[model samples]
Target: MSIQRRHTAQQLGDCFKVAAELALPVLGRQSRHLDGLTDIKLVHGIVSGQGKLSGLRFTHAWVEGLDDNGVKYVVDASNGREVALPSDLYYLIGEISPSECVRFTPEQARRHLLDAGHYGPWCGAPFEHEDPVPGVAA
Candidate 1:
């Protein structure tokens, strides 16, 4: 897969929502705690698809739950417990193949977030390039 131009917050968040929705079915059978949305996760991408994979081609998806045992349990929200969300359930939209998924890494996510300040909705938090708020301690 070609290296995708880095994603912005809206772009990456959209992708995360995609992975989250797909996981919902699996999560529905396990925990209701997902309703609370404790936090969202950005995790490592894995290799699956034609051709030898390296770096970017091998992608990652954002998951809602942590890895427990050998499998990743998802947030059910309806039941409030963890259920395994299969890795196979994730696939990028409109990609020629699964491998084309533009993986979102945590570091990339951080950068996207930092960049968001330029156009993000935080009306009070100043951009990093600008003067700091007296006590905000960002």
Candidate 2:
């Protein structure tokens, strides 16, 4: 079956928060499925796609990892549902450029969060210097 495109009103601009939660066992939460994954990295970048966010380049975050078979996948929970797609497919659909992405390991992510005090576009990407959502601090 083909992967379905799903979006939720609540998840519109919460990509960073969702990604952080998924990548680290913060708030006493952990994704059990990620236990078997390897080389996991939290990524932040500008993304534009063909759905509600069509034609709009915005800061987004997600997790990337390799499965046991060594296939790379992009896992996103920003839509309020976890979706894992092949990294190439996800990048193509989101119009994301590898060179423009900022990646962090779980340890690095924790440090950044502690240093920046927020889930963020910490690398100062031209498109993302501030929080995407105002007053939310996520």
TM-score for every candidate vs. truth? 0.28, 0.78
Candidate 1's TM-score: 0.28
Q: What lDDT score goes with residue 87 in model 2?
A: 93
Clashing pairs in 2: none
Tens-digit per-residue lDDT, 48-132, candidate 1? 3332222323233434544433443433221122333444443322122433323333344445335543212122321112222
Instruction: Please identify model 1 stretches exceeding 4 Å from their true place.
Output: 1-66, 72-84, 90-97, 116-138
Instruction: In angstroms, give how far residue 60 of model 1 lies from its true place.
Output: 13
Candidate 2 yields a Cα-based lDDT of 0.74
Q: On residues 1-83, what C-alpha lDDT tens digit does candidate 2 reach at each position?
A: 12223433244567787788788876354565566789999998767756765765666789999999998898888756777
lDDT: worst 10-residue window of model 2? 1-10
**CA lDDT scores, all candidates in order:** 0.34, 0.74
